[model samples]
Target: MLRKIIHVDMDAFYASVEQLDFPELIGKPIAVGGDGARGVVAAASYEARKFGVRSAISGVQAKKNCPGLIFVKPRFERYKEISTQIRRIFYDYTDLVEPLALDEAFLDVSNNKIGCPSATLIAYEIRQRIYQELGLTASAGISINKFLAKIASDYNKPNGQKTIEPQEVEEFLEELEIKKFFGIGKKTADRMYHHGIFTGKDLKSKSIEFLIENFGKAGAEYYNLVRGIQDSPVRPNRTIKSLGTERTFDENLSSEIFLLEKLDGLVQELSLRLKKSNVSGKTVTLKIKYRDFVQQTRSKTLPYFMSDSELILDVVKGLLFQEELKDSVRLIGVTISSLNTEIKKLPFVIQLEFDF
Candidate 1:
């Protein structure tokens, strides 16, 4: 049986949330990030996107793109509150909801609580409910599987929906641009283009053996994707693999003393995150990025799991001085892996407050 999958993505989530709370920001080009020299945009409102402003770009560049662009500091706790509300709505229909981020998720409604057979209708209702309850708009794509559904969601974005019937999957993919396919990044698309693979049809023409020889293990994945054969399930409780935090300085720091000061703060933030998640790990990795953009990492595995700030800081300090400074540092990060968490299963219970 073809599994019914729906991928719902919030329209400019962070920026929209800011606009919703601050009436003056509505319809204005706003970015959810710092406006400082070293600040990067976490999200950009649709109005800001019109001016070529986008997420991950420097705040300076965003301002250059649109002089009227407004920058608001991120309120992560508020975003999480809204995200929880959204997930409650998803659980109303199905327990098989896989959240990719705070803004997007994949729902497996082939066997749903409401016994709704039409995935498209379920998606429409979900989007409507979100708008009605939270004043936030969402876009959705409905199809036979996760990959196609995710791709289709982007077809009609920002408060819209699309459906790709199982029968239409073949023709739709054939005409789809290779770069638009899920899991294919810009670099990979460029490599495919060099081999004259411009569209799904072109990708389908290559033999699996030829694909494997050129692209390694990913070649087989491409072959199956072009054939509409993705079978990954929508897992509601995804295991937490690792937790981390990082900081990028406005000015590069060359002194070891300054680097230690920065590490102190990072360790504290990471510890809070670990405690909130209720997980600890045995491995701590320190990441260093120099002013020239070259990156390096130093890792140490402890005999026991730890999440305390002091323990993490001790490991980071040792790593920081383990090697001499290659150049002035611009960014530093701490990551804890090899977690004690094996399988985290969140209890699935429908929220009763929502009428629908």
Candidate 2:
């Protein structure tokens, strides 16, 4: 069956939410993140992007690029609430929804609950409703598969829609820059350029084996993409196989006490998140990286899903003890995997006050 995939992405999600709440910020360029030296740009308004201000760029540098750039602290709670509202809008059309992040998702509406034959029509309705009901704009891409749909969505962005029919796929891809291909990053684009591959036409001329030889296993993927032959499914009910968080410290630490303190904090954070999500895991993994960028991981799978911090600490401590570090630690993280979602929710007050 020819799949109908719709990729929907909110335009400048954090900045849009800011503008929604504060009408004064509507026309101005806004950057959502801290303005301090350590600050990174989390999101940028369309106005900011024109000034070369982008997400993950330093706020200090963004200010230099766009002197008029207004920086705002992120309000994650508000964004999460708005994300829930947007999700409800998607569910009204199809149950086959796969969220890529809080602001973007792909929906397979080939057989929708609303019986909408045209995915473009559904995209228009959803976009209009989001604007009318939430005062937010969205960009929608409609095509036969995920890759094409994602590319189409970004074609006409910030309150726009684009659709690519199967017949036009080849022509559409031929004119596209190789960098614009779904999975090609800046580093890969450099390699492509070095190999005389600048456009889709150049990439298409190469055999699957040639690509694999040059780009490893993903080279075959690039070959298929040039032909618009993506067969990946828009998976719904996606399982969280693992959950973890890591932080790169500004200063390297040789103190074992400080390392343990950081580990303790991570354990608490992961435990709270798992409990809140009503999921538990059987594996405990500890990751550490030295100042030299050398990294190592140690993992152990328990007999059953556990939510215990003490046990987690012991496992991590043991892992740390086994490692002989030659340099100061620059990063540390903890992860839990092999998940089980069966959880009983207790009363909020009781749950907050009591233990398992």
Please report the candidate that would top TM-score against the real structure.
Answer: 1
| Candidate 2 C-alpha lDDT tens digits along 1-356 | 57888999999998999999999999999998757755667789999999999876677888999999999987767888899899999999987787776788999887778866788889999999999999999999988889999999999888999999877889999989988988898779999999999999999999988999999999988988899888777766656678886666879988777888778667755664554344678888988898989988889887988765667778778877876776899999999998894333322111011100
Number of the predicted model whose lDDT against the real structure is largest: 1
Name the regions of candidate 1 deviating beyond 4 angstroms: 243-297, 300-321, 324-342, 345-356
So what's the TM-score on candidate 2?
A: 0.74
Q: What is the TM-score of each candidate against the true structure?
A: 0.77, 0.74
Task: Please write out the lDDT profile of model 1 over residues 1-356, one tens digit for every residue.
Answer: 57888999999999999999999899999998767755667789999999999876667888999999999987777888898899999999998898876788999888789977788889999999999999999999988788999999998999999999988999999999999999998778999999999999999999999999989999999999999998777878877899998888989999889999778767765775665455789999999999999999999999999987789999999999998999999999999999996778665433221111
Taking all chains together, the TM-score of candidate 1 against the true structure is 0.77
Please give me the total number of clashing residue pairs in predicted model 2.
0
lDDT of all the models against the reference? 0.87, 0.83
- Overall local distance difference test of candidate 1: 0.87
